[model samples]
Target: MGAAEATDVESEYSSLVDFEGPDDPSHPFNWSLPRRVWTTAVVAVLNLIGTAASSIFETGNGQFMKEFGISHEVAVLGTSLFLAGYILGFLTFGPLSERFGRKWPLLCGLAVSSLFDLMPALGHSLPAILIGRFFGGLFGVAPVAVFGGVLSDCWPTAQRGIAMALTVSLVFSGPTWGPVFGGFIMGSSALDWRWNMWVVIIAGLSATALCVVVFPETYPPAILRRKARRLRKKTGDESIRTASDKEGLSLQEITRVYLIRPFWLFTTQPILALLTLYQSFVYGVLFLFYQTYPVAFGTNRGWATSLEYLPLLAIIVGIFVAAIGIVIHNQLYFRHHCHTPDGVFIPESRLPPMIVGGILVPIGMFWFAWTATPAVAWASPICASVVIGAGMYLLFIQGFNYIVDCYTTMANSAMGVNGSMRSIFGTVFPLFATQMVHALGVARTTTILGALSAALVPVPICFWYWGDRIRAWSSAKVATF
Candidate 1:
């Protein structure tokens, strides 16, 4: 893996310089499975902590509205703007990881995010906390999208399905559990909403510390470039270059790729567009339920404070259950579909679970919405949350796996676009969820959203049928490693 070896290998290949060999120890793919598991676990934990920040703010939804003397929508701007910041952060950090490397940007992002996370705890005013939340979320982008890039760095496609399921499960389960902690904190008359901010700071800092102590560079191109640099210094051969070293972009080009290209891919690629839409709507509905949770339990059902937060557990359970279900489905249904007749990994089979999820989402939504009132048993809505939660997690599990499989080395860029778009949708949903509920009533509002979800059933269907043709038209520059 040294520069001299790299130079000799480059000379040997003539066409391209890849790892020294298929089993190059420098490659993450060649790492021991134990090491890969540890890396995946660390990245998953960071992603969980980052996503939790978004929903924990909602646990204090009541206090924020009252303190600022703002309307519900305006109060929602605290979490809304925080999520909106995700759009900005994602546009930069995930793509930045592609250009620079994963570890540095990830650590820098965590450091900046932790600082911003602490800001809200110190500030008393709503505008101040809103700004804090915005910056905190803005800086958290690395953990959100780049984790996929990290996972892709280590796990091969077959094992990647379950690894991604665990990552996606935590990505969601963290937020669902955040409110549980937030509820207990806010429930106490002595503790203020700021405690939620402090909790995130402590956790974010802890995760950052673990990352610094343990995280090794996983980006293969970055690793090879380092070796090339060393080889030049050792052999005095400035001509030695990793493939990525020769193909590297200037800052201007990198910036343009970051700024303009995702919009292009998002708008142009049928597979990316459809998957984004499906995940976005399902994501939006999850956040909407965040706003509606209190109304469903505390306001309508007259449940106690502690019990009101308990229902969020249904979704958490469903996420774990759905992760298991997807893993099982991958083993059974996708065993053959993952490989072509020639044994190359096929990415489109990732869409099958998504198709099943699309069907389940509307059914779950309709079930939850109609059974949500006090006239129904409380268990009905909570169980309905499970169904909705399972479907949402399934979509997420499949969506991330699908994108990674499709884009391969450029997975970060694709997921950056995917994450940015969905975060935008999540930001918009909470802002109007209460308003929608008020105007239409919870049952009618959720039912309407469910019907909207049902309308998009053809999205996954068409992708399953025609994904290869769509990929042939995609503009994404996928690198073969």
Candidate 2:
């Protein structure tokens, strides 16, 4: 039927179930503040554990090499394959959350990923450990992939900045702290490298339990669907149906809409495509540090092996500091120009922090490149890492905020493209990091990364000036909340 015919039929259905009004307490947007905050915190913790698992294996490389009689390059696959698995997870789970709901996909993924963690924890062979890490990343990605949807569900654009900052901070901090935790775990005289995987299993299962007990269904359509069912049963009216009940796509339609749409958005939307590329590059640089940090602090300075991962903590501190900056920006700018007199939200308001972040990324890289020498005090490079950390955090959180604001309802698909692209970079960057440092030297390798980031600084700056026009140029029929 045509649109008019469908509307006429929907109006004829007196038993249709929906939220009573905009302020209905059953709607996720109308949920109490404490409940929303608690849900966001739970999702963030889950994201931390999933992303942390991506890098934690690096600290166990020595054990892997010794146990398997493999070279360092070969052992790096444990990290690389885990990241490769993230691409699969993003592609699978991000859209699934849109179809199913956030809660079950997240809980199920966490539980299964925890089960896979046992493969690495208990397996004796290298293949078993590597395969387990890959599957663990695959199943563990629901929290990372579906998080933006939860934020969009529970908070309005006006109040989402600080939540995004705090959550994304944990997202990045997970990887930054992973190796640190793994370092200590591996350092234990009694614990083997397998203990690292065991930690992931413990954390994953605990997070799942918390979500099962605390999290409610936050997706609007999913909630409406359930409400429709409840109303149908209570009133003995089989005609009770939600608007989502009308959206029964066929198998081919489902494939095109959910599976193909993200890749299409990534390729067609110039703004999304370019920003995703920039985000991917920044993410790649982060993984590069996993390889280069040891060289800068340990190999060159003669620091003990276990102590080398400490510099990563500087990055974590910068992440929280950037979170504070985002909160301030929301208070100062969002309150002023969030909407025009006509009440159209200004998505460009999110760009200023990202612009500052773009500038700081290259600056920090250059600073670290020059100061990361045994001749200089160790504090200098560590401080540079702080700058890099702050810069990366702002870039990541604001980019997400911008997409969530701009795309609104389609944010999950946009994020799926984003997560997959960055995971690709995250997977590939490290495999060459050690080689790049060996060939170019630490200063030169870092200088090259700095120059690359410098070239992309125009992205946010240009978007700040012309994002409205760029968004207008898009033909996609994206629905705004």
TM-score of each: 0.89, 0.93
Candidate 2 off by > 4 Å: 2-14, 233-236, 476-481
- Which residue pairs in candidate 1 collide? 3-231
lDDT of 2 by residue, 231-259 (tens): 88898888788776776689998777778
lDDT of 1 by residue, 83-147 (tens): 89998898888777877889888888877888887777888776777888898888976687678
All models: lDDT? 0.81, 0.87
- For candidate 2, the lDDT comes to 0.87
Give each prediction's root-mean-square deviation over alpha carbons: 4.5, 2.7
**What's the CA error at residue 109 for candidate 2, in Å?**
0.8
